[model samples]
Target: MKPGRPRMKNDEKQNLLSAGDNRHRRTEQEEDEELLSESTKTTNVCVRFDDSPSGLGKTLQTISLLGYMKHYRNIPGPHMVLVPKSTLYNWMNEFKRWVPSLRAVCLIGSREQRNALIRDVLLPGEWDVCVTSYEMLIIEKAVFKKFNWRYLVIDEAHRIKNEKSKLSEIVREFKTTNRLLLTGTPLQNNLHELWALLNFLLPDVFNSSEDFDSWFDTNNCLGDTKLVERLHTVLRPFLLRRIKADVEKSLLPKKEIKMYVGLSKMQREW
Candidate 1:
């Protein structure tokens, strides 16, 4: 959850994407092409946002790629996007706002409701993508495992930094052809965490943590030149970093209007 931000009320849910901005739309398209090319060329794609900022359009780009694949590449997906429970509807709204043609379903609610969704909607095989929470994925693993997913995306991917985590273990069991991880945090310092992410992305390439660790040992090294170089070489193909300043250059800096108020006698005492 975002710090200092209150939870969104049911009636307050709105389209996350900007409306009628041709320039922003063009920029998003260009970035989507880059993301599409990179994702298709490699088995695993990691979109890392260095600084979380509004209007970077990561969700839009991902949606666009799904749409492109469905229409242009002839890959009408049985895709799955696993997100936090709070942002489940946010993702659904994004899919509708960005790529309304693709059928996206949300797997949530009570047990009976979920059963109805599974019976009526999921089993029909009419949906292109399924947006669900981490808890739901675990609860319905049996049902999810039945399908061969085309794309499996995990937002806030750092939650699986530990290879032994329940979420990590469960997700690996699913039959997914393509995997994409979206994170709005840095993953540079911890080599083990980095390896865990890489292992998830390309299990064949980065299977051994011990070998990976020994190869880039930072012990007793002056500048860690070799380690840095190796890290770059390994990450260059799979990781696409979007810095807030770089992607949102056209966006204006937020203006803060400060106000000073005199404290009352009760306020001061408290």
Candidate 2:
């Protein structure tokens, strides 16, 4: 049999994780140490991007960033990635394939199954990142809010365009130090929708919709070149837009293959 790394007993694991529990009381010395350390910690902001062509490696870039933070920056995180239900497994697979060094866990399954996972893995801090579906987050939000996440990433972030959305509201309540929003499409909708994303990223700066509108009034001048340029200037610091053709020249051009098959008589009838 192949040997494996040592595994901790569940009781030992729970005891170790409990030390970092948010509810644990801290001594005055510990608080002072934290205050001193805060100044040296680099603040991470929301990384928002759009206008990228399909297959532009958005997911790959995000995975690499998490890997970098964990391995190089020494920020072995308890990150949370909220993705569409359809892509939950795919994200977990990519994390394992590309950055196996970082422990990635998926919070999924039935209510009973999920509860067991939370008790055994999630609460024990056995993972560096937790990848879960939007629906699962809704169901187990309270459990998630317990962690002070290093990064809160949302795939298909357009789902939170509406500030009033349940997902948006719930995500805003998460105790996360950094956030990343990944979307394949541009914010072609109204400015308010764009503000929703910004608000989630930097609530202090983009706190009021009225204020945002007053600065960039696109109500009557949607096509105003100056307005577009100004908006780009504001977004340049936080946004990164890239195209596959521009950055991925080494990749071969896409090729299509078509196959045709006749349906059986019974299948066609159905």
Candidate 3:
């Protein structure tokens, strides 16, 4: 929808998308061009906060996330928003109203387009950003396997809160340089439940659930801030956390809330 993004014909996009019969080529330049066009723009992050379940929490958290991403750090790869089927477009609308410069691709496609796009990202600096549902990622496994991800932002990441689930296994399978898990509820089930999510973000940050549990038990009822901050060693490579009170006290006063739902694009240079 933004200017300069090349438009493609429906039949052409459809034909390219429907490559059930032909596997020899990408079917069109725009398909490949979109990937190169997107990955080059901006790094996106997966974000979460402690108070996210409160009113205005999701929006405020997402707003803070955009600000933190833009001003505090510019991670080197495009972000992929992985959420439930319901939350995918909520993410799209947030990006639309908040960070208009970002370009996004919904991982929704005919079997062919999804596979082709993933192959395209194998080249460095392709697709400024991509968003996909957890189901879609599993569906597009062949494509997802082809490239190394600059960052993987798992929204409602609790979907893989269990380390052994097939979804969690698939997420761990990707070659990701950075990882962020976003969820409102941090201590779901118990502190031990947090381990699987943290482990995916930083392998063995706790080493074992019992290890953190023991440390918490021994330290006068205080958990290991040292082990938590020790996360800096691995997590700094992947995570950033901020609270809404950190910024936007004024902009958030009764902001209008609307949800725009759609599976969505790519754009140009800096």
Candidate achieving the largest TM-score: 2
| Best model number under lDDT | 2
Q: What lDDT tens digits, residue by residue, belong to model 1 across residues 66-132?
A: 8977876666678899999999888999999878999999999999999999888887777899999
Displacement of the residue 171 alpha carbon in candidate 1, Å: 0.3
TM-score, structure 3 vs. true: 0.54
Model 3 whole-model lDDT (C-alpha atoms): 0.59
lDDT of each: 0.75, 0.76, 0.59
The C-alpha RMSD in Å for every predicted model, in order, reads 15.4, 10.9, 17.3
Candidate 2, poorest ten consecutive residues by summed lDDT: 1-10
lDDT of 2 at 71: 67
Query: What TM-score would you give candidate 1 relative to the actual structure?
Result: 0.72
What's model 2's overall lDDT? 0.76
In terms of lDDT, model 1 sits at 0.75
